[model samples]
Target: MLVAAAVCPSPPLLVPEVAAGAAPELDRARAACFDAVAVLAAARPDRLLLVGTAPEAESGDYPAGSAGSFRGFGVALDVRLGGGEPGPRELPPSLTVGAWLLERTHWQAAPPTARALPDTLPPGDCLAAGRELAAGDERLALLVLGDGSACRSAKAPGAWDERAEPFDAAVAGALGTADGPALAALDPVLARQLHVAGRAGWQLLAGAAEGADLAGRLLYDEAPYGVGYLAATWS
Candidate 1:
């Protein structure tokens, strides 16, 4: 069963080395992410599973200790899913961010197992995957990573769109309250058009926590660099 969960944005900028001088801008988001991970640790789960957005071809399961690097972003930093023998699997950017979070927190409760899912994945499939993952005796904790709409301003990655603000606001509200149904109900087409990479990941989390009676607390919600980044904890 899902005992706890942490929701975070997947931008590579979360890493100081990647963000360079702009790192200070995300200090609060980073702090919130750490706090959310602290909550996961407090849950004392027997296992930790990380889910994140990735390219369709890259979407798949990654074993503990799978490696990822920020070399593509001109950073020399390397990260692994958890403490274990290094594997040949290379994590996509989103999982790379998740691995960085786990490393930052020094997750000691359990070695993390990870999955990367494409943003275009159907909601039903995401839910089914979550249910399958949660159908076990082990106490499971999740670290979900993906970004929301990236079209908040003209300079945004997706450029300005009138619908972006409302879409992101709804996402922020759902995440803040842990409204599973609401997350599951997001419009895939609209989300995709708005460049909301986190939609599928959030739906997966909703499915995992289908009947869980955890309370939620929104730690951070902001659109820095015209991208929506959120941090929240459910426990």
Candidate 2:
């Protein structure tokens, strides 16, 4: 069962090297994400799972020791999930960020298993996957990554949409309270319209957290570059 969870945004910009000169802009988010990751370490789970959104070509299961590189983002940096020899698969951008966070923290709690779910995955399927993931006997912790609405402002990636604010507000609220049902209830149609990449990941979290009495703390909620980036911890 899930013993703890950390929610973070997946933008490549989270890596200072990837962001270059604009790195300072996300310093606060970077700090908050570290704090959330610390929570997972404190939980000392027996198994660590990293879940995120990815393109169809990159979506699938990832074993411990999977490797990820920032070369795709014009940086020579490379990271490997867990600590063993590299697995056969290359992590997608989302899981790459997750691995980066673990490396940044010098994580030693558990070797991580990563899974990248496609953007088009149905809500029901995402939830079912999460439930299945949580059925094992080991104590599990998840580092979930995905972006909220991409259209928070006129300068946002998707440009300003009148409906963006409310949509993100709901998402932020659910993360702050660890409201699994609310997360599972998010309307996929609306999420797609609002350009939310977090829907499937969040729903997966909801499924894993089904009956756990986890307490939540919202550590960050900001859209520095018109993209909704959030950080939270549940324990």
Candidate 3:
């Protein structure tokens, strides 16, 4: 199996032609959502799975009037292949992987800000969901998440330095999208953080200067945030 990951590096809030400024919070949320989808696709497994929990009301800084967030959600897509003469009963495999991933991974509440929530989404639950969706076929699995710190920073448990390269620039270059205006508008620190995450994403998929390839012949495209995007094939 091979994997490829890419980031969009912050898509335009408002159309480039529009004069209105982009919404920072909204952009961040959108980018995070898109990044999650990209991660799952990179895994290139038969089924797509998502495992996460909503914030508790007692949790500090919980948003008022917010419905409980998605603790976990998952979806499975059926793929079929046929020889030369396509049979009418045979279905196309690419009917809608992107849309399926989007529909399955979307979150209603704010993205997980603290590590507590994601940790609650145990690997067991993720695996179970994938199993059910894939009918017990678990040869490989894909995991995706938002939060820049999730990929970097040693503070979080299980945080590894596997892929630390910047993912933002590579995504931008691959998707043929730009964030010059957004970067100029953001605070220097935030801008730098975004860039760093982008680079890290690239490094994760592309590998370090002297490291082995984590993914092979992976295809990348532009997404929402300055996050990298990737699509990989796995067994």
Better of 2 and 3 by TM-score: 2
What lDDT tens digits, residue by residue, belong to model 2 across residues 1-235? 9999999999989999999999999999999999999999999999999999888988998998899999988999999998777878799989999999999999998888899999888989989998998897779999999999989899988898888888888888999999999999999988888789889999999999998889989999998878889899999
Q: How accurate locally, in lDDT, is each candidate?
A: 0.91, 0.92, 0.29
Deviation (Å) of 165 in candidate 1: 1.1
What global local distance difference test value does model 2 have?
A: 0.92
On residues 1-235, what C-alpha lDDT tens digit does candidate 1 reach at each position?
Answer: 9999999998999999899999999999999998999999999999998899888889888999899999999999999888788777799999999899889988888888899998899999989988887887789999999898999999999999989999988988888888999999999999999999899989999999998888889999999989989899989
Q: For candidate 3, write residues 87-136 as lDDT tens digits.
A: 23311111112222343445232221111122233333333332343333
Inter-residue clash pairs, candidate 1: none
Model 2: residue 84 alpha-carbon error in angstroms: 1.8
- State the weakest 10-residue window (summed lDDT) of model 3: 90-99
Question: Distance from true position, residue 70, model 3, in Å?
Answer: 12
- Candidate 1 residue 66 C-alpha distance from true site, Å: 0.2
Model 2 residue 14 distance off true place after TM-score fit, in angstroms: 0.8
Tell me the spans in candidate 1 whose CA falls farther than 4 Å from its real position: none
Off by over 4 Å in 2: none
Best by lDDT: 2
